[model samples]
Target: MKRIFEELAFVNVFAPQSVEKTTDKTTAFVDTSGAGEVAFLVSTAALGAGKKVTVTVMGSDQSTGASAKAIGDAVEFSDSVGTDPQTIVVSYQVDPANPRYIGLKFQHDGDAAVLCGVAVAGRSLYLPAANGWTVAK
Candidate 1:
């Protein structure tokens, strides 16, 4: 016999899983003394083939003091990073036009698995985030 609430209980009608960004107290401000790259891990629940994930780096202009950064382009998610434990490391392309911002994109285009683990790093030119992810110089 079919249960009354069994169907509803198994149903997962929600948005795609995502990583939660917390405030970095130690390296929250961008300075010359200690300013570098930032790493972020995307949740496995939302990691899949053909899935689109955008990573944005936030920073401020020293001269103008205005907000600035770069955004990653959409790419296919693949398992080329690893086999059983697939993970790819894509560096953010920074240029003179987009100064102080390092944007990276990793796509899983091979196997369809939950990508839960992520390891990201910041470059020397990269700046720290005010209320987002950042790394120490």
Candidate 2:
């Protein structure tokens, strides 16, 4: 099988203003429309002790509005080694019927802000077509 990769979103360094709050914390959304498989990757440069980060995959039927739903369980991480870079990765399969666009939601907790970078990527595999050409190439 041939594999194709696409970058959904990237953040060199996280900032407070780049996120939207849902209830008590902040969230960053990444659009992964028409993706068959997705991988959410998060990296922290200097996460302080007691700090926590959660990455959740969200989806919606329309491009905008309140029809969004959480696709899967949120993947969470806590600072184990202070001042050390932490990385988190989560993978999911997209449903074709619903959730036309996928959203990556980042949730932050604790007093100290998380100094981190986040990237979302999608992977698709295709077999060779009748003409001996793959979908990616």
Predicted model with the maximum TM-score: 2
Q: Cα lDDT for residue 30, model 2?
A: 40
Give one digit per residue, the lDDT tens place, for model 1 in 1-137: 65544321111111233333221111121222222334443334433334443333444444232444435444434433242443334443334444442323233332343424444443345354775675657
The digit string of per-residue lDDT tens for model 2 on 3-117 reads 3323333432234233322223323444455456766666656556766777766777655524667777877778776667677876767667656665566766645544545
Candidate 1 stretches greater than 4 Å from native = 1-72, 80-83, 103-115, 122-137
lDDT of each: 0.36, 0.57
| Clashes per candidate, residues 3 or more apart or on different chains | 12, 0
RMSD of each: 16.8, 6.0
Candidate 1 to truth, TM: 0.32
* TM-score, structure 2 vs. true: 0.61
